[model samples]
Target: MTRSEPDVRAEQEALFSTGAEHYARHRPGLPAVLFEALPAGYGRPLTAIEEARLVIDAALDAVSGIAYGVAHNDPELAERGRRTLARLRAERRAPLSPTGDAT
Candidate 1:
């Protein structure tokens, strides 16, 4: 059965709360290949794997920034968090171009 939005979010929050410390400590650094493969913009439809990777990267970036901001008391990290989150939201809302491209 499908889970409701609140259920999904609650589960995710529980998972993060339990693992945030370990995640902060042991999270692998982003591979250069991942960055290299990113398009300059969403000008074409991404493959399923590419889309998943992008989502994960954006989530991680935002979360990591928040953690860093808390640890270091740096406001710039919060700005980065905001930008990354906005990018993710835009990606979700963006419609395909006339040619069925992502842009």
Candidate 2:
């Protein structure tokens, strides 16, 4: 932020780290319908297993334990979130069922 700029500049730009797994961990889970209802640009929907794998990867990535009580908090979960997002993209075009449903 430039010193001359007003304080209400919305911090220049809102941040969106690709690995924000806070939603996957601290936050309550999202609904199945929400994933199925992903916007048209999500590429394709995924099967139950594919979705589960994505979530599992995110959960694992959020673990940032330390030998003592002095560790960086929030689990540094970006990598896992990235993997999950990638999986979601890959699964978008895959048939979700034998009937050829993508979700």
Instruction: Specify the highest-lDDT model's number.
Output: 1
Lowest summed lDDT across 10 adjacent residues in model 1 is found at 6-15
Give, for candidate 2, the lowest lDDT window spanning 10 residues.
Answer: 8-17
Give all candidate RMSDs, comma-separated. Answer: 10.8, 13.1
Cα deviation at 32, candidate 1, in Å, is 18
Q: lDDT tens digits, residues 1-103, model 2?
A: 2234532121211111122233545455654343333322245554455544444443343332221213434334444444545654565544456553545
Off by over 4 Å in 2: 1-42, 65-103
Q: In order, what lDDT does every prediction score? A: 0.52, 0.38
After superposing candidate 1 on the true structure, give the runs of residues whose Cα lies further than 4 Å from its correct spot: 1-46, 93-103
lDDT of 1 by residue, 1-103 (tens): 1244532332333233323433444565644343333242335555544444446655775788878987899876666676567756776844546554566
Which one is best on TM-score? 1
